[model samples]
Target chain A: MKWIDAPWIELLRIALEVAATVAFALSGVMMAARKRFDAVGVCVVAFVSAFGGGTLRDLLLDQRPFFWVRHTEFVWGILLLSLAAMLFMRQRHFQPTERAMLLPDAIGLGLFAAVGVDIATAVGMPALIAVMMGVTTGVFGGVLRDVLCNEVPQAFSDHRPYALCAFAGGWADVALRQVEGTVVSPLLACVLITAGLRGLALWRNWELPAWRV
Target chain B: MKWIDAPWIELLRIALEVAATVAFALSGVMMAARKRFDAVGVCVVAFVSAFGGGTLRDLLLDQRPFFWVRHTEFVWGILLLSLAAMLFMRQRHFQPTERAMLLPDAIGLGLFAAVGVDIATAVGMPALIAVMMGVTTGVFGGVLRDVLCNEVPQAFSDHRPYALCAFAGGWADVALRQVEGTVVSPLLACVLITAGLRGLALWRNWELPAWRV
Candidate 1:
């Protein structure tokens, strides 16, 4: 029996990434409709924000031909959601605030980072590079999102603790993985750390020190 | 003494990618502004559409540290442009039907695919993966741009001659490199093929068959 596989957790991670993809896509559509952008532009933004981070993670890890290609379901979901958003946008714009995407987004941040770090570490990347990869996988998607949307990322701009929260969770997860003779699972460590940090940051308004030029 | 580097052509390639990046970013911002999206959403859309493809290609190729991280200037350019687009949006909303992006985007298609193929081949990737990388690098960004903006990618949409042109260019580039010792510059072959295909596509109204779901 493969005692270490953690299928349930993996499933949850997949589900979380999928949910985040949907939320992120909706975010793009909502913005596009608001801007009165043409159909092409709206769809482009939706796809990028939804898939950008995972694609980056997979690519850096040299895991081809990529997730969207393998999982027609993910691509299909995006297509259907995009069509729905376009058709009923005037009457029914998606509302992330109203929906419960925050927890899933938080899950995405942690899992993406943990998995990124694990891959980087396995490949013998330097600790700093691995950490950076972890953070990049975790937060770059949101940063890309904000930049395309035409603003400094809220975490980076408002001195909020977004990436840092992910970073902390990543650090703890990575560190806990090395405890002597402990069966501390990477997935469990990743989930707990990510969720914990994200929740704490939200509750306490934890923030990073802002750069002032 | 590195005498055969093709300085002018390399410069041209870099220049084209840069121009395409700006044009792509602008298109993103234009779309966001027209949709009346907030600043954050606009920036997110612009950044992802512009950087999403090449970034994905690099990461997938396991080009460590990633090109964007190494070439921080690209991020700076995208940032500056996204900011400008958001601020000046009310002054000038992008009209996609006006065709401001067709040429720059084509240049991007040619240059990015060529670069992606070059990078993949150098890394010893198999030919099929290399071509896929080239195509992904060339066209995925646009796919991404459309998705984020909440519309079906023109590549997968009705009668849009978008990705097929890029795909032909990438395959042609790969074939050119496979010639007898191919002392002939691979990138030059890529450039000619891509530019020709993309131009012919626009002029001749070439398009790929869309999925019939």
Candidate 2:
């Protein structure tokens, strides 16, 4: 159950967790706003995008009370953020741009991917399942968000490098875990690999070939 | 865990489970076929619509290994059915219609709603949450299906009595459980209540008032 015994690493994990949550929450808010969802819908979408993946991972691992149920503050945080964003957007006539979401979204994907791998491995899951869980945890929230917004999941249809980046990072994590006396922190390395690849893909307009009938 | 210990009730429950799975799987297949998805996509969508709700409920209840994992036959069955459906549609030039799906979908909704409530109550969850879980299980699959097909959830926007029918049936089950020596079986009563209400709604063209800005 102990992913990190060191105090510094624990603190760092907590910081990264917050960053990931906030980043995803913001992305959710923007998506909801773009769709002109009501305030309640906006909050619901935000909550789903920020927590859906972790919730699924927790359930698969048989964790109790679910994460949002265990930490009600996360729900309240998303609610307030969505409301505030709505008001701010209205006041400034601000039109949310997808570019604004990319950086935070990339960071959150990397952090969550790392966390998912650590949690699955700690639970004694096989390497393949653990890696699948990491990608699922990293990508599922966005899928849920897109679904709620009534869009074909960009992950599936747009042929973007989103899930691919998480998949690569997850394998990198599993590999690092097997290496004895790894020179770098596996979590940090996974995060960098995922975020860096995603950032590079966005900059270079990289795309996976679309599936055809 | 002992939702029904009586031999007859157990047999009925098993039958209902099979019927419900097949019904939802058919609905999923029809939806996917309408979209002209590839065989793999059809199978994935069929599996999601047949199992999505119960999977979420099980996860929230902290049940491990997932229902699908425990019953791999359901997976194989859905896969086979979806493939067969695609072939049949192509050969017959059958345009899958929503009306053709209503009967089985309603029956499956009722059965799954009852099962969801039974499972949640067996876990000692509060009655309200249990009822909520029931409605969620009944309707979430279709929600997932529509989302995957790039449509706003018919449940949310159609203003139909779909989820409300499940809500009412869930309360009926919870209430019947509290009553002593009811003339009818509580499980049977739930199924009748849910299916009857849904059927009536469809027949009468019942609609909920839409929320407007």
Per-candidate TM vs. native?
A: 0.53, 0.61
lDDT (Cα, tens digit) per residue for candidate 2, span B1-213: 243466766576567778888999999888877766655557667888998888888867877676666566677688799778877787787888889999999999999998888778777889999999988888998988887889778889888799999999999999988884531366777889999999999999998987888
Task: Give the clashing pairs for model 2.
Answer: none
In order, the interface RMSDs are 10.0, 5.3
DockQ (Cα-based) for each candidate = 0.05, 0.14
Chain A vs native chain A, TM-score per candidate: 0.76, 0.92
Model 2 C-alpha lDDT per residue in residues A100-140, reported as the tens digit of each score: 99999999999999988877877677776677688878888
lDDT of 1 by residue, A1-213 (tens): 133356764465566567657766776666666656788767777777677776766666566777678777987788788777788755665443423546666766776777667656666565555655677777766666665766545434444455666667667666766673332466457656876788787778765432111
Off by over 4 Å in 2: A1-4, A8-12, A15-104, A124-133, A141-153, A164-213, B1-48, B55-96, B121-133, B144-152, B156-213
Winning model by DockQ: 2
Q: Which candidate comes out best when scored by TM-score?
A: 2
lDDT of 2 at B1: 26
